[model samples]
Every structure is written in C-alpha cells, then in structure tokens.
Target: MNFPTHIVAVAGLIINDDKKILLVKNPISGWEFPGGQVENGENLIEALKREIEEESGAIANIDSLVGVYSNVQSYMGWDGVSYTPTKVILDFIGRYVGGDLHTSDESIEVGWFEKENVLQIIENENLKDRARDMLEFHGKVIYRVYETKPVYSVKSERYI
Candidate 1:
C-alpha cells in the first residue's frame, strides 16, 4: 500500500460576513482553516467542499479563489516525531449558504473572527495576513512551493 504524493492538494475556505472571517480551531494547530488532504479522483472544488463540510459541518457555496499556501510551516511533530512538510493548498472564499455551525473532532472550536480580534484566536501572523489577503485578492494569489527547496511564486486568478 502507498499514499499518493504529487499533485496532492489541500484547501482552506475563507468565509467573511460583515467583515468577520470564519476560522476554525484545528485539533492540532491552535486555529486555522477547515481543510484536509485532497483524495485521488477529487477535483479542487469538490475537495474544498468536502473538507470544509467535514471539519465545520456546514455547506459552503464557492465564492472565488483566494490564494494557495504551504502547510509545511504548520506541521505537528509530536513527541519528538520527525516532521516533513508535504502539502500544497488552495485557498478559496467560501460563502455560508446553509447548514449548522458546529465543530467536529478535527477541530477544537469554530467561529468567525474579525481582523482586529483574529490574534486572540489564531496565533500565526502569517495566516492572519493571508486571511486579510483573502478579503481582497491583491490582484494575485501567493503560491509557495517546497520540494527539493522552497520557491515562492504568484499567479493572478480571474476569479479573485
């Protein structure tokens, strides 16, 4: 048995209402987006929908592509476990269409946080800035790649 490696993508759904961002506390990380590894045979849009729904128990309507980032900086190396970052993520702006808002075992807590109050909930400044960037695509989305080395790239998405 083997796990698929390349082309594996995860996604974070950014939902904002009245200038507040919806963020969830990951069971491992303090708080971040509700996302997971994209399984084989699933498209980007489908993976985003399933991940967000699974973690937050809410159905989100796809709004637009916000950005993509690496999950390397947030790896969990518990009990002296060696960690290697290996995930490419696509971030999107998902709007809450319907469904209950509750936290799953994958999360510790779930709720929306404002820019000013995001610090109290999420400790990662990088993620906070990314969250802010989600509001406005900045005319481009940040793409960081980590293979034999780390590379930073940018792309302009027609949607965001």
Candidate 2:
C-alpha cells in the first residue's frame, strides 16, 4: 500500500570559487553533499542550518531555495521488512558564511572539487545529474518526480 509520506526536508548544494562544489566521502563509499531530514516543528531554513553544522561543522547562510524533489521507489530492510515506497526531499542552495570545514560524527572526509571533476566520482547517476542541474541552472528552480521503483531496497540504494 502507498502510505502518505510528506517528509519535508532541506539540503545544501554548497558551492565555492573555481566552480567547485563541497561533497563528503563517507568512511564507506560514494560521495554526497551535507544534508539530513528536517525534524518536526522546525523551520526549513533552521533545519538546513542545523544539518550543515552537524554534518560539516560549518555555519552557513542559506542563499535560496533551489528545488523540490519527490522520487518514489521501493524499500526493504536488512531483516526483510517492507517499508514505504518513496521518500521526498526538499533541497536548497546554501553558502558557507563562516566556520571551518572539519570532519564530524556524520562525515569522514569533506572537500571541495572542481565541477567537472566531481561529476565522475559521485557514484550515483541521479545525484550527479542533480548536482549538474544545480550548477547549470543557478537561480532557476525545478520540480522533479519519479514513477518507477528501484529493483533493490532504498536502504541499499546509493543515495536517497
């Protein structure tokens, strides 16, 4: 059954000089920007700031709302429990105003890379596309929806 899932969230598509973007490589594998789920009763901007701080240990000022994404896919647990088919995430463009980029409990290595260079190592095709869209469009916002489901569970998927 398709359950009602309106998980409001915020993410930072942070950028720097030389057309470089900030991304993190986990202690495991793959690469992604700093983001997390927005908590109950918290404003979107507040959630973005809090997630950025916790994930990258940097204080950032959100620049603008870039886009809203909703992708529906199947999910299954390690123990084989079926869950919701899709989870939607709201993302924003954020700028690092102050603080240092250091490793935190949520990340292992964080660094900025050239836009061309970053595209190759992102691991997930969809995420790479999203990053490219963010860079190319700049202030232009977008809304995306997915109808298909993944063969593997969401937990095993590279990115959410």
Candidate 3:
C-alpha cells in the first residue's frame, strides 16, 4: 500500500493595522502574497509564519482559514523529465504583528499595498482569482478545484 502524496503549500493574506496587505514579487510568479511549499515535518502554521517572514520579512499571526484550493493540473517540472505533483494550497487570513518589511532571496520586492490594489499587482490569473475570493471572504471558507495548463479554469467551487 502507498500513501497518497501531494505538494502541500500555505499562503497568508496578511493585513496590517493600516489595512495594507503584504505582498511579494517573485521573478516567476510576478507579484503574490508570501507563501511556499511546506517542508517535511513542519507544522502548517509554522510553515505559514516561516514563509511570510522569509519572503517578506514580516511577522504575521494566522487569523483564520480563508480557503482551500486544489490545482488538479499537473505540469512538467524544471527537470523536464518528471511531472510535478498536484498542489493542495491552504490560504489563510493573517494579521500583521510586527517587523520591518524587506525582500528575501525568493522575493525581489516586498511591501505593503492597499487592499484595492492587490489584484492589479498580481499578474497570475489563478492567484488573482484566489485573491478575489480571499478579499470577498465574509465568514465562510471557500473550496475550489481548478486546473492550470493550457489555460486556467475552475472545475468547481463551494463555500464551506
């Protein structure tokens, strides 16, 4: 018997007291919230905090889960010979606690932006959609199934 394996990641839509959102700019993804794949043996909340700090030089407290998304589309890895694993992403709402904002090796730019301006900074459609869902979150947790390859498309969505 084999245990199912997937690439698990965590992201934070962190808002400061000024209502500004934390954002990071990477070469590949353009602009996005701070997040990355979870390492083995790392707790999800720890991973979220670590990623936020590492990518944006900010300390954030995980407030609540905003959504869970699955990218069913598999793509070729950089190696080109092997396919990457399916991705399961946990998106959370976070409160900015402290620390000066700065960019890390993974991020070329890190700063706070007005909430209304986030969508414009994020160039990836998939991320923009997720940001919309997060920004529109009232009280329910959103669940979405989507594919990204030839084009990004949503297979299904649910408010939980």
Q: Pick the candidate with the highest TM-score.
A: 3
CA displacement after TM-score superposition, residue 105 of candidate 1 (Å) = 1.4
For model 1, what is the C-alpha lDDT against the true structure?
0.65
| Model 3, span 85-104: residue lDDT tens | 89999999999999988888
Better candidate number, 1 or 2, judged by TM-score = 2
User: For model 2, which pairs clash?
Assistant: none
TM-score of each: 0.71, 0.78, 0.96
Q: Candidate 1 — worst ten consecutive residues by lDDT sum?
A: 151-160
- Candidate 1, pairs of clashing residues: none
Angstrom error of the Cα, residue 28, model 1: value is: 1.6
Better-scoring candidate (lDDT), 1 or 2? 2
List CA RMSD, all candidates.
Answer: 5.2, 5.3, 1.1
Error of 1 at 92 (Å): 1.0
lDDT of each: 0.65, 0.69, 0.92
| lDDT per residue as tens, model 2, 4-28 | 7655667777876445678876654
Identify the superior model by TM-score, candidate 2 or candidate 3. Answer: 3
Ranking 1 against 3 by TM-score, winner: 3
TM-score of 2: 0.78
